[model samples]
Every structure is written in C-alpha cells, then in structure tokens.
Target: MPPVPQQHGHGMESPSIFQKSEMGAMMGGGVGLTIGFIFGSWSIIRHGAGPRGFMATLSQYMLSSAATFSFFLAIGSVIRSDSPLALRMEAMQLQLSASNPILRSKAESAQIVRARWAEERSRASN
Candidate 1:
C-alpha cells in the first residue's frame, strides 16, 4: 500500500479513537480510585475503626471506586464509537443555540463558527 500522506500544521498526530477511549477510561479510573481512597481513609480515621473494620471499609470503598471507573470506561467507549468529536460538538452547539435566544441572535455563519470552534478546540486539547 502507498504511504498515507501526513497532514501538517497540527503539532502532533491525534490518538486513534480507541486510544482516546482507553485513555479516558484510565484517567477516570485513576481519579475515582484516588477520591475513594481519600474518603475511605478519612472515614476510617474519623470513626476509629479497628484493623479488621478498616480492612472491610477499605475493601468496600475500593469496590465502589472500581464500579464508578468501569461505568465511565463504558461511557467513554460508547461515545468514542458512536460519533466523531466534531459532530458531537456541533450537535451540542446547535442545541445550545436553539435553547438560548441570546446565543442564537449572536451566532455567526455555520462555516465560520465551526472553523473557529475547531481551532479553539484543538488549541485547548493540546
């Protein structure tokens, strides 16, 4: 097969959809676990749990965190598979403009709005 032409201007290549989804899941899980651990530790310390009780409480918190992480992972995977990011943002903008008269009144042409939105989104993501 011929080599795929690389696009210039974008500073770095974007991750594949699957990679993005996996990263999202990993990040979500890490955050969930961190939060759960902090809360669990606080609760155990505040309640003055015995060693056995501490272990039980810790286990419960870990399980709950795992569930929350898994939920986010599933959502991330579904979102990545279902639509491209640009399309999703366009839909969101449309909904926002429709619901807000002030925003609608100030809206630019679709082409200009989309170009600016894409540029800003890329900058922010980077």
Candidate 2:
C-alpha cells in the first residue's frame, strides 16, 4: 500500500492523560452519588428524624457521600497511576483478557452468546 500523507509528520495525537482520567473519575463519582441518593434518601425517610435522629441522618449522609467520593477517587488513581503509558498497558490487558478463548468458548455455549455472535458476524460480513 502507498504510504499515507502525514499531517504532523507521523506524530500521533497526544491527549492529556490527566484529563482523560478525570473524566472517568467524574463519571464514577456521579454513579456513586446516584447510588447514595437512591438508597440513602429512603433510608432517612424510613427511619424519620428526632433530635438524635437528625444527627444520625447527617452522619449517614456524610458517610454515604464520602463513600461515593472515595470510590471515584480510587478509580481515578487506578486510571492515571502511571501516566499515559500505564493507561495504555491497562487497556491492552483488558482487551486481551476479555477476548480470551476459554472465556469466549464458555460464552458460546450459552444460547444468548450464540445468537449474538452469529448476528454480529453476519452483520460484519455484509
């Protein structure tokens, strides 16, 4: 094949690693907040609040919020732990593990997988 003309002379596009990780962490934090709100509001309402109950509710809310924040914080740390290089390595690992033959074979045994793969393959060949 003829070599494609280069825009930046073969240099690849470089996205900021920190920004990408922040986005994932923010998404995880949103997920955690959603979980907390869905579960925590009901918990407070169900329990009701007197003076001690008020304190208890505040405590629970703080605990739940903290839990949510920490969960996302951990996700960010994992994603950006070693900069752009580590992130690429982790992505490669995920792709390899997810496509392993043993796992794929097990999935193929299930009727759902058979139907899905057949559909996908047929679609692709078109």
TM-score of every candidate: 0.45, 0.39
- The weakest ten consecutive residues by lDDT in model 2 span 6-15
Q: Which residue segments of model 1 deviate by more than 4 Å?
A: 1-13, 50-52, 73-126
Model 2 misplacement above 4 A? 1-14, 50-63, 66-70, 73-126
lDDT of 2 at 41: 70
Q: Which candidate is the best by lDDT?
A: 1
Candidate 2 lDDT by residue in tens digits, 42-81: 7767876656765566566656775677566757666654
Report, for every candidate in turn, its global Cα lDDT versus the true structure: 0.72, 0.64
Tens-digit lDDT string for candidate 1 (16-117): 666657767777777778878888888888886666788888767866886698678857775755334677787778777856543443456676789988
The residue pairs found clashing in candidate 1 are: none
Give the range where candidate 1 is weakest over 10 consecutive residues by summed lDDT. Answer: 98-107
lDDT of 2 at 66: 54
